[model samples]
Each structure stands twice: as structure tokens, then as C-alpha cells.
Target chain A: MTAEDTAAPARRGRPGYDRQQVLEVAVRLFNEQGYDATSVSDLAGELGVTKSALYHHFDSKSAILEVALDDALSGLESALDDAVRSHSDASAQLRALVRGAVGVLTARQSRVTLLLRVRGNSDVEQSALRRRREFDQRVAAIVRAAQAEGMIRADIDAAVATRLIFGMINSLVEWYRPGGPVDPDELADDVLRATFDGLQA
Target chain B: MTAEDTAAPARRGRPGYDRQQVLEVAVRLFNEQGYDATSVSDLAGELGVTKSALYHHFDSKSAILEVALDDALSGLESALDDAVRSHSDASAQLRALVRGAVGVLTARQSRVTLLLRVRGNSDVEQSALRRRREFDQRVAAIVRAAQAEGMIRADIDAAVATRLIFGMINSLVEWYRPGGPVDPDELADDVLRATFDGLQA
Candidate 1:
């Protein structure tokens, strides 16, 4: 869903907070306090709203979690789709995938952080993880294709390579600050360089 | 502390569980349930012991947290120290550090996972974070040194590079299972090859 969708005036709910605002606050709380530990009241207290007011925007914490996780997974899935459609070669597809993944991460840091922190505690979390695994498998397939085409190194297993490469990219959530010194494109480029080319001088 | 220290008999407490056993269960619980949400009583219940019996070993939940975090941090610190002392050249040192870290991470996967998840919610967590940051800075310094010596790529900022490299290494906690398909040494080799030698065929 677009920002506008979240930002759209709450048709049936309180006027002060939009769906996007509620989602953002909810994701932040989920990240700070463990998802299971964060109750609807905890969310309401954080938002300075009554439980009913909070419930007006979202039915349950699980609903918010599902949306937050979908935001991350959809972005990643789109990146993978775009990478494949845009690039004719396996190697190019791999590069674009890395770049697009970085874009999604920086643009939606908190949601992605929450997504990664999910440990399949609930149905929503388990579904998110399933989608994540599918995304990983898709990436690994590209790695294998690239290896077969003699574009990327064949010495490393495709699955291992995909994990390590994305591991570096996903790490952006931990330290990358938006509006910080490093831009998204630059960070993507750095990741591309480090992974595509050896760090050996 | 060595495994022996943890495995040592509880001098003042009941039989069956040792300090190491308590620390392992505590770390696992902290990893599963966020540290703040987990109480000493919960740990006692998990271990099938009374609160007093658990307290006889760990005084408080925070005490267990401290030891758990220390187990992770101390392993990392020792890895850093060994990497530094064992290698004279910065590039070799960087390689050694990566390898040593993989060793620590795999050997103590659960504790390292707990350490990575710490968000500094309490004084104990805050102290653990401080130690982790110090560790990060030292790793970055080695990256800078290696860059200056023209042993590694200099295009990316050393700090950024350091984070990305460790990020890949640290991702092991999420997926690396003991006695799994990937062995520790092989995992380290893949990481080093991907980081140091690029993935290009």
C-alpha cells in the first residue's frame, strides 16, 4: 500500500491519527518491546490514545504486524521481480536485486526491522517467514543461474552466497540512518562492489 | 570463561544444574522471550526449579543476563585479541578476525544471538552494548589499517565496510545451526571468500 493509503483520512475512526501513523507507531513499539509483550493497551498508551481509539484504526496487534511484515516482504518481492524483468543476464539481475533490496530497506527501515525480528510466534509471523523463505529461494536461484553462466563465482554454494550477500545488505537495518552521510544509492553501490568484486586491493 | 567454569558444580546450590546449564537456559529464554519480559521465576519454571533454587545460582534475572551477555561478548573480545596477536599484517588480521568471529558465533550461537538482540533496555544491556560498540570500533580500525596498507579495497569507508562484513558474519546467528549442513570452518571460508575475494568466477 502507498503512503497515501495510510495517510488517507480515517473514514470511520478518530480524526487525529491516520492508518499510516498508527502502523508506524505500532511497528516501532513492536520493535522496541517484543511483539508478544506489546499489548493493545501498550500501543494505545504509547500513542496517547484510548484502547478503543487505537482499535478504531486496526482490529488487533496481529493485523498491524501482518501489514508491517507485508510492507517489507512486498518490497523485497517487487525488488526481485524488477531485477528479473529488467536484466537480461543473471549477473545483472543479481546486482539490481541487491540495489532494489537496499532501496526498500532504507525507505522502510522500521517495518523491515520488525520483519526481521519476527520469530514465527504467530500465524502472521509464520506466513511472513514463509514468504521470506520463498524470496530467499528466488535469490538463490538467480545466484545459481549466474554461477552456471560463469558470471558469478561457482565455488560457493548458491544458497550460501545468497545468504551472505543479503546478510550484508540486510545489515543496513542495524546501522544505516536515513538522512545520514551515506545515501541509499551509495550504500547499494558499496554493497555491490564489496560482493561483486573482492575487497583485495 | 571456559565451558568448565560453567559446567562446574554449584557449591551452594542444589544438584543437577550447573552455572553453565543455568546460563544456557537463561540465554535461550532471553533469546526466545525478550530479556526484559523474562523473569527469574520464568527461568526457574523453565528449568523446573524453584525461584529460590534459581536464585541460589543467579541472584537475579539481571545477573543471568550479565553472564549470558558476557559469554557472548567475552568470546568476541577474545576472538579480536587472538586475531590481533596472531597476525602482524592488517589484511591477515582482518581475515583472522572474520574467521575468529565465525568461530565464536558458531561455537556459542545462542549466546551470540542473544547478544545481537540486546537493545540496551537496562543497565546490564547498556553495558553489553558498550562492549559491543568497542568491539565494532576495533574491527573498523583493522579495516582502516588494511585499507591504508593497500591490502583491501579503499573505495568504501572502513567503518561502513566493517559493518557490512560483520553484518554478514553476524547473520550466521539467524540461520547457522550446529551440526547443520554448513560447518563452522566452511562457513568462515565462504564468508572470507565472498568478502575478501569477491564472488566473481
Candidate 2:
């Protein structure tokens, strides 16, 4: 069957519930109730569709999880890559990485939240974790390089520094609302200032 | 019955599995499989005892959860209280709070991990979250005081700063291993230096 032929049934059932919409709702439900606790039946119930209609959009729950996780990991990876390619100095690269990460996180809060919560229970989760660790290592490498260049502090271990920096950034998912009082730019500035300029007067 | 008489059965079942021991195991299991996923049967199986024997220590899973959450919340509350009582300035209070928090988290890693993972699924979890929010507000008030005193940088919002600082501190549970190379003192120093001195040289 053509792609349109396969998509026709789900579209008719839910009108606007396409693949992206299905993934979005699934991610929201996963974030609310947890991926392990949230079943296909729950998703179907929430979508007001039958199990078969939900299945038409995605083969299985894990398939939806993979897509949601990829949505987050890819955004981060792209942010890192753009930051690196756009900046020559490690300090600039580090700043851009933090800013870009904040952007991706705010833009895709639920997906990133789900990504952070993955504990490597299943094969897909394990792979997502591997990607996350790789991202951390890459960020740490920049920290190490910046330290070597005498731009960033050399006293703190690069690995520890990376975790702490991203720790602050990642914590945004817990408390940051998209249209909240603290806009994304201001939030990024606050994080960057707190991390780079020290909080002490 | 007396406390000793009540504890005697649990102690006899596993020889050295006192109330504290049972709590530690339950917290670990909760962290591993999540609080809701773990059942009384699961706890009993992990303890190598019958369900009734497990009940001899705690009335219900929620009871264990309440105590476990209290273990972490109380440690943090003590840290905040001691930091305030000992330090005259907000800067010192903030530093002491961070240092004391590191000590608590490192000392009771599993319990802290369980505390951070609580999502207000039950009344016990909601109470823990409320206590956590109060702790955050207390820290934010200190940040505001510090900013007013011109000790801490005033550019960042106190609430945001409080979350970022604790975010870095709380992330320790994810990666920090007790008895690891990074001693708690050194970890605290790193966090303090990174936060107060800024990472940029």
C-alpha cells in the first residue's frame, strides 16, 4: 500500500491526528504517566480512538518512544554541531552549546524531559542513553579544551563541569514553562551568566 | 507491643534486617524499579522473606515511602537550617547550604535518589514535593537576601538561581558514587567554585 493509503484510515478516525500529532500526544502521556506505566490502551483512550487506529499511526509503543527520543537527541546533537561549526574558540563554542541546548529544551520540553528520564530499561532506552553519554562526553571535551586554552577554569574536572553545567540546563524541563515569565533568551542568559561570571559579586 | 518486640520478628526473618535495613533496601528497590512499580511482594522477594514478614516492619508500601521521603527531606531541611543558623551572610549561607546538601546527598545517595524521583503520584509523594518546594523557596529567599546585601550577583532571578544551584547539586545523584574518586568535600568545592567564581578564568 502507498503511504497515503496507510494514513487514510487513521486520518478519517481522528480527523487531525496524524503521525506527528500521535507522537506529540504519546509523548505528553508518557511524560505525565511515564512510558512504562502508559500503555497503548491509555493512549488510544486519550486520543479517543481505537487501538487499531493508534496502531495505524505507529507499529508499537516502543516505536513511538524511539521517535520521541530521537526528536530530543537529534535536536541536542544538531545544537552541538551548529555550535561547534559556528564557533572556533572553545569558550564561544561552550556558550553557544549552552544557549542552543536551552533553546532545544524549551522548544521541545516534553521530549527532552522524556529523554532525560530514560533509565536504559529497554533496548531503545539503552541506545538513547548511549547517545546521551556521548553528548556529555563531547561537551566535556569542549570543557577540557577550553580549560587547556586557559579560557575555562582548569581546577574542576572537565567531566564534572560538563555534568554540572548541563545539570542546570536540563533542570529547566522540570520547572520552565514555554510562555512563562522567564523567556527562553532571558533564561539562557541567566544560566550563562551564573555559570560563566560566577554568582558572587 | 514494645518496639523491640515488634522489630524482633523482622530481625529474626533475615538476621540483621532491622527497620533501617529494610528501609534502605526498599529505597534501593524503589530507585531501581520506581516506587509505584515495586509492590509488597517484590519487596518481600528482594528481602528473601514472606510478605507477612515484610509487613512486620512497615504497615504498607506507602508507609515505607513516607519514611524514605522523610529521610531525604529531613536531611535537606536540616542542612538548610544549619546553614542559616551558622552563617550571618547570604553568601556563606548559600555556600554552606550547597556544602551541607552535598554531604547529605552523598551520605544518603539512594534515599536522595528516591526523593528526587518522587512525582507526587501519592499523598506521600505530594507531601515530599511540598517540602521540597518549601526548601527551594527558603533557598531562593536566601538568594534574594544575598543579592540585597550585594554579595551574590543580582542580575539573575533569585528563584532561577536557586533552582540552577540545586539542579547542579541534585544531578550528583545521577552520577556520583559514594567512595568514588570525587570526595564530597572536593565535589562541594567544585560546585562552589564553579557557581561563585564562574567557569571562565
Candidate 3:
């Protein structure tokens, strides 16, 4: 990321730097440099702002993390909501959720990396972790419903199944760079196909 | 983890602390506390030894990480090698690889977690990342050979397919507690069943 990505800091009290812009820079920095190594002063330095200027937007580094994690997970939650409301067929609903998840992951690659890798070491991280579990439970419920309806295999436990499928999807955080080799659309398609249709010839 | 887990600090000239014991403690600390947050002093404090005593076994934290990553990946590489040599058919080979991977992962949970989550921030981390990619490439080659033999679907890229399968398996790091709700044997079975025979009814 270049210095120009973030607008130059005009003055300490200036309103030129947007909250979203600071967040974008902050997330990228956090992902590149581990969160523990990144400081508020570091964020300010990258943003071309003073320490107080950055604090005006976020009280602490953890506050930025809270918003960043929320940014990553909210898209997923909303997408699942849309999938549940639109699809009645259990298989279709589950497939839609998987596709939606990949889309969100690709769109918010850096934020998702931070969200998925957090170890719940702080209040903000713990909240993100809890929300992740809640999201997993919601998906697991869908799997259970699908199994009961005989739309999917019943032998595997619903929670286990949910973890595996999402596990496949979430691994995108590790390798999927936004402008890298595979485009997001193609990546999502391949993931969905592999998940629903076994790789067997 | 109690102070008792680490052997007491012996005389500076003595070889009381085993290299394996130091590695085990390092991996646990790395997993519980993020690698960046963990320090030589922290390891010494936990081990009831002086910093020099901890350093006597491993020169630096990065050196410890190198050994830890190697410990995790070597098991996986050897498992894949054994599977390829022992199995004739592609499907059988792939099945063996998946099962073997789960077994290694379950046995070395903390080490695997460290290997999977490292973000390539330093020379040691970058080397670990390269090794991980090489492992993924090896698995992809198996998938491609399997597809050629009409054992697995050819429509998806071998790389993509391998990732999705391993993603599901690797997710055990996130949720599979050694003595937690799911048993290792059962977890391995369910993972294999879900991968080869997907959830579709």
C-alpha cells in the first residue's frame, strides 16, 4: 500500500480523513503487521496523521479492531439472512449460504483474515469469537434441517458438517489475494461445486 | 499448563531440560498466547528457569518457531509420502492422505495450529509459508492424478479441489480440542465421509 492511498493529513482538527479511510488503512496494516505489533501511533504514521488525530476517530487500537471485525462478519450475517428468507429447499439454502460466504470473504479479504485468525485474547477479540460461534450455530441449524428433510447426508453430525463446509470456505483467507491468480467469482464457483458435488468422477 | 509442566531449572552446565520438552512448552505458549506476544522471558518464567537456560536449548523465539513449524510439517509430509507409496488407486491414496493428516493433526494439535496460523512476517515465518505451499502443491498433484484416473472430478482445478479438502481437515485446529466434545477417531471418520461423499442427498 502506498502513502497516497490515505489522504494526507491536513491538520489535527481537520475533517478531511474519513473514518472508513482510516479503517481501510488500519485493517491492511493490521493484516500485514500482526495486530500486537501494530500501534495507534503506527496507524497514525501510515495515515499521515498525528496520534491525537487518529484517536479522534478511534479511542484505542482495540476499538478499531472491534469495528474491523464487525465489518468482516456483518456481510456474512446479512448474506445468510438473505439466503434463509429466499430459499425453502434445504440444499439450495445451504449452497446459497456457502456462495454468499465466499463473496463476502473475497470482498473483505483483509478484515476476514483478522477476524478468522483472532485468538480471543481481548474483549474485542472475544466478542468477535462469540459472534463467529453464533454464526456457526445458525449454519449448523440449517444443516440439521437439511439432514432431517433428507436433502443431505444424515450420518455426519450437523455441527461437524457445518464446520467442514465453512472450513473449506474460510481457508480462502489464507490464499485468496484480491487481485491475485484466481478471481473471486471463479473461486466461489469452484468452492460451491466442490462442497455440494463431491470431486468424484 | 502449570509450572510443573516445565522441568525445574538445573545447574547451567547440566542437560536437565530436554529439547523436546522445551519445544512442547514453546508450542503451547505460542498457541495460547499469540506468537508475537510470547517471549523468551515468558518461556523461562513458565519453565521456572533463567532466560539463558531457555536460550541454551533454542537460540531465539524465531528459532523455536522454525523447529515447531518443521515438527508440524514433517509429520504431514511423511504421512503423504507413506500414503502415496502404500496405496495403488487415486481415491484410495487420497483417502489415506486425509485420514493420515487428521491423525497427525490430532496428535500434534498445538504445533499444527502454529503452522497453520503463521502469517509469514519474518524469515522463519516466510520459510514456513513456503513449505506449506509446497505441501499444498504435493496434495494438488495427487488430486490431479486422481482426476486423470477417473477417481475424482476433473471439472474443478486440482489445486482448488485439494485446498477445499485440506481446508476442511485443517479446520480441526480451530475446534478440535484433544479431550473436548469430539473424539479424534470419530472426527477423522466424519471428515473423510464428508469429503469423498458430500452432504447432498
Candidate 4:
């Protein structure tokens, strides 16, 4: 095996750029600096590619942002879908959903940070915002169903309850790092325990 | 009283601007468009003032951000103080703290939105971020105390538990609108219930 053979496979996909790799770098940059603060040139420089080379893969910065947000949201939506399909009891399904969210958030922390930080300034962001609202509504529906089945308190509005629960979960993007003192599974369980069983002794 | 007398009192301070009013408007614009995206000129234009007039109160845009974040934090700190002073038990104090956060969050939603979005870009933001961390640590200490007393689950780390609970509370800035179907007081109650009793039946 020569030096060429050792390094050749690393750049096999698209000459110094993999689409997923580019998106990950972009998400990290966007998370560290405000998305508006980061420019295409900044991304290109960070990726060690020329401006034109970066453009070849993504048409525009907004396109990159669209993909990044989609990456995070896709995981969450899939999690919700799986939880709904797998569980019959609304309480169990809700717990599964919280667990799923923690999994996605922990695995995709940077992308989730970018997704949560989007302020809907442009058309791409507006679309992402719409999808987020839809996802929230779907979760609220689950809360309502759980309430109807006498699994959770009905006194709290379903919409309010859903936001409060997810707020706890979504906040993981702000403080949670991938490798930390706490394990992700334990964090998920604690969130589930707090959401379903309260923190009272 | 004449109509002229009522109109004159409306613009009572600083000939044309009030410091609190300017900070409030700045926070609203900052929330609508990110702090980095919104400029001093934009704030001046929005406030119907000359750049000099805006500068008379705030030395720089960062100064405005400083005041805006301070406004939100001051409310929260005071709430924490009152909760600690008023309640004997950690559980009651925690509930009071959550209620106070909801109150400040609802009343000063725009400022809280601005506060939450600060990314430590400048000295002003860095200071605000430090204060926020301190507040979180203080809250986590309360959680630790509560757990020690056997009033809350001991299985969860106090720091992790604090973030989870506050995550749910802080999330209000994203979806909560003051004049919607849910009242602020009721939202506070729901949050307290969700925190102490949880969502389970």
C-alpha cells in the first residue's frame, strides 16, 4: 500500500467534497456564527474549496440551509412517525416520542442548533418555520389524544402542554453536547420521567 | 382636561424618547430580525428618530442589547430572590420561580426573545451569557437541595434536571403570544403542574 492508496479513498466522492460533509461543516459554521453572519466565502474557505467548487454542489447558501434544516427535521418527523406506529397507548407513545427526540437531538446536535436558531427571515426559513409549526401541531394532537384517554391531565391545554414538553426536549440543542458527563439515554429517561411522572417525590 | 393636555403627557420624557420605551422597541425589532441583522439605522428609522437622538440614550447598538438583556435578567433574578425569600421549602420555591419566569416571559416576551437569542458576539452579549449561566447554576442548586430533601427524584443529576425544567419554561419565548387563547397566569399554573405533578393521569 502506497501513500496514494492510503489517502485516495478519503476523497473518492466528489473531489475534496462530500455533500453530507459539506452540510455538516455548514451547519457547524452556522451554529457558531449567526447564519446571516456566515457567508458563502466563509463556508468555502472552511471547507478548503474554491467558491466555484462549493457552488457546483449547492446552488446557494439558502439551499445549504434548506438541506441542513431538513436533515434535523427529517429525523424528528421519522421518530414521531415510528412512535405513533409502534405504540397504542397515548402515554407510551408520548414517552417514545420524547425518547426519539432526545436520540435525534443528541446525534444531530449541530444541525438541530441551526434548525432551532432559524428566525424565518427568508423564503427558505419561512418554509422551515411552517414545517416546524406543523410538527408542533401534530405533537399537540398526541397530547390531546392522551388527555382524552385519561392518561394525562386534561386541565392543561393540549397545545400548551405539547410546547412545554417539547420545549424541555428541544432545549437540548442549547446545552447538550454529544460527549458529556450525562449519557443521552439517561437524559431521555429523565425527561420522560419528568414529563409523565412529575418531579415530585 | 383638554385633548392637548392628554397628548402632551404621552411624550413626557426626553422631549421625544423614553429610555425604557426605546429599549422595548429595540428589543421588538431585534426579536423580529436578529440582533446582528438589525442595525442602529434601522432602529432609528423604526423609532422615528434621528441617529443622534437614538444615540443619546444608547451609546451603541451593543449598548441597546445590553440594556435589553439586563431588563429580562433583572426581572428573573428578582423573581428568584422573592421566591427564595418567600418560600421555606425547595419545592414551593421552585414552583414560585417557574411562575415568576412565566410572568416575566409573558409580560416581556419580546425582551426575553432577544435575551434568548444573544450568541455572545460582543462584550455586552458575553456579560449577558455569563449572567444567564449563573442563573442556571443557582437554579440547579435549588434542584439539588430539593432532591436532597427527597421532594424530587434523586436519580437525575441536579444540573441536568434544572436544564430540563427550565428548558420547558424558557421555550415559551418561541411559541407563546401574550393575547392568545391561554392566559399568562393559567399558563404559569399549567407549567407548575407539569413540573411537579407531570402529564400522567
> In terms of docking quality, how is candidate 4 classified?
medium
For residue A184, model 3's alpha carbon misses the true position, in angstroms, by 2.2
| Stronger candidate by TM-score (1 vs 4) | 1
Q: Enumerate the candidates' DockQ scores in order.
A: 0.80, 0.78, 0.69, 0.77
- How well does candidate 2 score on lDDT at residue B132? 96
lDDT of 1 by residue, A1-201 (tens): 223455566455544676788899898888888889899999888888788877777788899999999999999999999999999999999999999999999999999999999889889989999999999999999999999999999889999999999899888999999999998999999999999997888
Error of model 1, residue A32, in angstroms: 0.7
- Flag the better candidate by TM-score, 1 or 3: 1
Deviation of model 1 at B18, angstroms:
0.8
Model 3, A48-159: lDDT tens digits are: 6678878888888999999999988899999899899989977788988998999999998889988987978799999999999999999999999999899888888999
lDDT of 3 by residue, B171-198 (tens): 8888888778888889888888778767
lDDT of 4 by residue, A1-201 (tens): 123333345554435556677788888888887788899999999988787877876889999999989988999999999999999988778889999999999998888888898878899899989989999889999999999999989999898889899899999888887778878998899999898889988
What does the lDDT read for residue B199 in candidate 1?
95
Clashes of each: 1, 0, 1, 0
lDDT, candidate 2, B1-201, per-residue tens: 223664557334354466787898999988888888889999988988778777878899999999988989999999999999998998899999999999999998998999998889889999999999999999999999999999999989999999989888898898998888888899999999988998998
Query: Mind giving the per-residue lDDT tens digits that candidate 2 earns over A38-145?
Result: 999999888777798888889999999999999999999999999999999999999999999999999999999999999999999999999999999999999999
Interface RMSD of 4: 0.9
How well is each residue in B1-201 modelled by candidate 1, as lDDT tens digits?
332336666454544676888898888888887888888878877876678777778778888888888989999999999989999999999999999999999999998998898889889999999999999999999999999999999999999999999999999899998999998999999999999999988
Badly placed stretches (over 4 Å) of model 4 are A1-15, B1-15
Residue by residue across B15-125, what tens digits does model 4's lDDT show?
356788789888888887678879999988887667888888989998888888898999999999999999998978888999999999999888888888888888888
CAPRI-wise, candidate 1 is: medium
Ordered from best to worst TM-score, the candidate numbers read 2, 1, 4, 3
